[model samples]
Target chain A: MNYETPPLLRLCNISYSHPGTSASLLQDINFSINREHVGLIGPNGCGKTTLFQLIMGLLKPDSGTILLEGNAVTKSRDIKKLRRKLGFLFQHSDDQLFSPTVLEDVAFGPLNLGLSPDDARDVSVQTLEQLGLKDFEGRITHNLSGGEKKLVALATILAMKPQLLLLDEPSNNLDPATRERLIEILRGLDLAHIIISHDLDFLAATCTTLYTVQDGSLQRCEQKQVHSHEHIHPYGDYPHQHGT
Target chain B: MISEPFSSGSTLFHCSDARVKVIGGTVLSLVLATTTSFAVAMIGFLFTSLLLLISRPSPGLILKRIATVNIFTLFLLFSLPLTYGGADIVQLQYFQISLDGMRIACLIAIKTNGILFCFLALLATSSTVSLGHALERLRLPRKLVFLLLFSYRQLFVIHQEYLRLHRAAQLRAFTPSNSLHTYRTYSHLFGMTLVKSWNRAERVHQAMILRGFDGRLIPLKQPQLRKSDYLLLASLLLISLILAGFSLNNPV
Candidate 1:
């Protein structure tokens, strides 16, 4: 049987809704991500986070299949293979990191994969070193600065060396210096990525293509074209909800 | 100096066959715990401590873990002698309590500290996940085992929320105070944290169901026991038995 190699991630007519909520929060999320540094932008409650959760396998679609590398991503068995191909940097660093120390936190994913204790430990140290966070190896994670915690979270995923990096709000809670370091780190890593952020400048700087979540659907926008539109203001009315 | 060996270690303990750790460690602890012999407890403590040391966790980590049960010891050390009555050196006037407190306090401290120390030694070398598995192997109910697992997951997530709350408070202008007003604010904060946690838990449960996580968490691979692991278990039981035998006879 000749089977075509699957794309990195594909959502075919995917839709989901909360149990009691009548409205479908996400519908027809039909997009195939292969090699673009895709920036997903939308106002709060516009299904941006929901899309992320679907990709991360934390939430499943109510009506469609989300595939990783051409394989269905529904099974726990598939998640191991899918996770090997995708690294999800959760928006909340605390949720991403549950371990007590820096090294242990970084090692969580690899150890979960059943890598022997010695091998997992080695990979964690190397990942931390590559991120220039060698000094943070033994520090208690709770004492870390906002940016440091984010770096640690990213490192936790980086250790996995996934083909597609799924990041949620990479610049949130970061100082400019740390943000720059993170941006550089992301730029240096050669992998297909889906970065979700509200920061227009960050999207403009790193993304080759921008996809905005609007009206329960994600629409890919034309590159180098800024339409005259009311973008979502952080502290004001959200753009996606305002428009339809 | 901070070696969080427990947190970073494999799903080995988490995914390991339950019988391996629970039946293994508990039987070991039981043989050791009920034995009132000083030699076995001391030898078990030393032997278990050596095993933990070989895990390469830092000295500070070991000490910090051992220190957690000190609260229980504090009560035993202070009140045991007074309540039980120690040597008659000092006596309380109002309630007529005598001061044979020192000797009784020593006995209680040693006894309590010894049991605690033995358990610490076992846990230091083993993971709780392994212990949980051991219980399941010993025919503990599946629902109870899962409840333990779910609560463990909840505890960590709740801890994360607490950190966020504390950080938010620190960022705000409000100074920490012991006044009634501050205490009221603290209660309010605690209440908010609980509400937030419940909402998150609800979301997580839905997510779990969506992902087809019905009651059981059948791991991809099963745990296999090696010859050396049994050797280690055997030596442990032997040492525990000897310690119990000696301690009971001596009662020191």
Candidate 2:
């Protein structure tokens, strides 16, 4: 299938391996994210996160080009400009919330994007309030509950108002209510995002398309296929349909 | 439980601007460090103790902090006197404690306690994040300020990671013993902690870059100093100057 307009994000023949090692972590990865929330499911170390790093221009691929809205991110300046339009939510909320307070953390992205301090702060407050975290502005990040930290981390990304979001395991460690809140937030979002998670129910609820990584290659899974797949949990061996 | 002592108070020192508190605390510590006279150092200790009393941190916490410092101070007090070859203060069968060494040790202990009490009363009275911001506003190197902020946020994460790893080990029925395996297991724990920390740092850096962070972190709004801040700084400075003048004029 072909489209007249360029995709929001396009990856062309991306491959990567750790330096000084020949075994490839990601090989010949190609995907386009446009008008859909893409869910990525895979085992640990299956290069889902590497693909994200490549898209975000954090890791240099051994071969290929990353195009954000059809423009190649070759130069540092180009990456910087492109990065402003893309947001990445790390798997660990600890990595995302590095600022001393929630307000500072949320405002960090806007501040770096050249907003004035007051304007950045206003944006931060609005973003936090939108996420039902208005009171977390002055809260110390570490002192927050696990669920609160996850939302705050998402707020940091949303405050930047990116065109594309790359969320790594956004639903991990979230309670049912918090997870529902997150799904609601993601559903209401107009931007395209590729969310990497093991939570099939979470993905089925919010994502329009799904892909699973296997043997360093990405394969798209239809909604029916995703629901029928066997999922594992630490508590018991059970597989149930998500009914997407 | 994680909250710092005196960090939530609205006392005079706590209400003062962090920039003033940081500079005042540092100056007082420096003055105490440089005072050669035992009497002047004791005066500094007394001054810091008075400040601590006024600030009213938990008495238990203050005692615990001072006791922790005194463990190392006790080592210095006992050992330094035997090393310096000067006038004999105590002649033992195996060791001859020098008068100069004993005096130096006393001065060192006094200075140590003075500085610790000063920090507890002033800098520790406020949140460390504010202290970092104040330092940045005071023209401290941006890298240093970033380090402080990063450490303040990441240290807790690292500690939690460590505890998780330890719990995992315990779940596997691993117990510590004085053996090579125990040593190796501890080494592995530490090595894994470092590896996890490095990976976390890389992810954090990636998240930063994804949010359009260039090399430099943009500064937030500068804190405004209130009249009370100025008063606190001035009074602390005046008291330090008088003590300094007295110590300079009459060197004991």
Candidate 3:
């Protein structure tokens, strides 16, 4: 099968490990993603998170190039510029929701981007409204429900208006209804999104293509098409791409 | 870690801004320094209290918070008269109390009350973020200002963590009741909280770095100084000056 030429994010000969840690977290890894919605499924303790960070420019690969829209992201300055085009949601909602209120928290990224205060507020309001969180503007982020907090965290980055979004466990710990709402929200967002989740059904519904990480390497799975109907959840044994 | 909980957003705290609080408060404090007379400091204390009330802080709540931090001040207050004797104009049933000591105590109270009251008005009314914006407006070192801004950011998180740990400790089935085990548990928690905070700090730092947080506090759209703000600031300075002048000349 012929794949599309040139991806939104292309990782070439990428390898990374924690700077002070004894062992390498990921190495000899790479695959390009042009798919609008992609899934990165893997077991616990794998370098799934590290790889996401690598792509977000949170961590630098020890050796190799991470080219974003054809520009190498090795230097700190370039990484800063590259980051403006990417929105990242960490696994923990508490890590991202630092502002006193939900609206301010969501507006954080937009504010950092130097958007006019009025414009930032509007963007944040619109983003939160999309997540059914318009009523929670004055509410403190810590007071929100687990599911609500996750959505609020996503809104914070969404307000930044990034072209590429990187989400870690977008559906983790959310109730079925909340998770479903997340799926709907994901479906509505028009951008290049890579989600790291253990929820297969959530992934199957929201993503157009899927990739799995095994033993710290990223491979292109043959299954790139969305499941035909929403009647069944994808779990257990299915065709998975072997480690490349 | 950011310095304060909220950066300069449109919270109730930002109305006055930090520079006005810092400079204006400092100028107000000078009048207290010039005079030991009760009336002069008393007037200063009153203005500060009025500012605190206007900030919309519950009087009881603000007092309770102020009291907790005042334990050390209380200690200092009690020991102040020791080894320093003054002329005694009145004698109690058993001991003669020095008039000078009485004067000194009064002075201390006035000075302490004035400073604390002013600071409370500054922080509780003006958001920490506003203070940062105020600092930036004042043309301070940009690097220092940014460091302070980030430090202020961590204040919100640290305040939350302190609340969390206190709750967790309270919820634990057994209270240590001032035993070594209690001390050990508290110490353990302290270490744990530090480690957790450090990890969080690292993650936040990474996030900040990704956003091009060069060591500069970029102006969040230069906070415009409106006419009313200048009016209030000028009036406050005028009040401080008059109070100082009257206090110094009063032959009480």
Which number leads on TM-score?
A: 2
Better of 1 and 2 by DockQ: 2
Pick the lDDT winner: 2
Alpha-carbon shift of residue B99 in model 3 (angstroms): 1.3
**Candidate 1 or 3, higher lDDT?**
3
Candidate 1: lDDT of A86? 77
TM-score per model over all chains: 0.62, 0.85, 0.82
Give the least accurate 10-residue stretch of model 3 chain A, judged by summed lDDT: A235-244
Docking quality (DockQ) of candidate 1: 0.07
Put down candidate 2 lDDT per residue, B62-174, tens digits, no spaces: 79988999999999899889887776668889878788888888888889999999999998998877787788888899899988877876787788878889999999999
Model 3 scores a C-alpha lDDT of 0.73
DockQ of candidate 2 compared with the true complex: 0.53
Error of 3 at A23 (Å): 5.2
True contacts kept of 1: 0.00
Interface RMSD for all numbered candidates = 7.4, 2.1, 3.6
Candidate 1 local Cα displacement, residue B189, angstroms = 4.8
Residue A213 lDDT (model 1)? 85
